[model samples]
Target: MSNQQPPRRFTPMSQFATDYPVLLIDSDAPLRELHNCVSERLNAALKYLHLMACTSLPDYAENDINTVTNIARILVQDVSDVFRVIEPRGFETLKSQ
Candidate 1:
């Protein structure tokens, strides 16, 4: 007697979304405007960080620390807004047209 084994076939499951949520971009604003907003906020944060007077750690006062933290918060909000609108690389179709 000869024994023959059957090949198995499998079906793929639907994709599941990641659990993390992002701060949503404003629907009323155009994409160009959103881009400008994100860029400007990031620029503002960088400008404050580059303040020459605060070059050394000892130069930072309590108010300076608060200002730096507030700038960081602004940057986070801007980034979260951006991530809300973009899709994962492989999951999206690449179009050249």
Candidate 2:
């Protein structure tokens, strides 16, 4: 007998559908607006939470609101930009179409 491996047969699984349609939705403008709104809200909430938490500390100062707000805004912007850049496929698709 010849030493040869049997040919592999390719078969499609019944449970899986190969040609399922992909529905691409366009909502970039709304999504960006929502993201901006949520980000601003979250940053404001965080600033308030930080200020509240700081109030409980011994060295808390009421004059630090500007500094805290500035820092929080910077952090929020950086995080927002990072998120936008990393997952920009949706935005790109929206722009292209």
Candidate 1 Cα misplacement greater than 4 A, ranges: 1-24, 52-54, 86-96
- Give each model a TM-score: 0.48, 0.33
User: How many clashes (backbone atoms < 3 Å, residues ≥3 apart in a chain or on different chains) does model 1 have?
Assistant: 0
Show where candidate 2 strays beyond 4 Å. 1-63, 90-97
**Model 1 TM-score on a 0 to 1 scale:** 0.48
Model 2 steric clash pairs: none
Q: Looking at candidate 1, what is the lDDT of residue 59?
A: 71
Clash counts per candidate, in order, are 0, 0
lDDT tens readout by residue for model 1, 62-95: 8977877776776766655554443232124355
In the range 1-97, model 2's lDDT, one tens digit per residue, is: 9989853222122222246523222223455764665477567858766766667554656667666666666556545543543356466768999
Q: Report each candidate's C-alpha RMSD, comma-separated, in the order given.
A: 12.6, 16.5
Candidates' C-alpha lDDT = 0.55, 0.53
Error of 1 at 28 (Å): 5.2
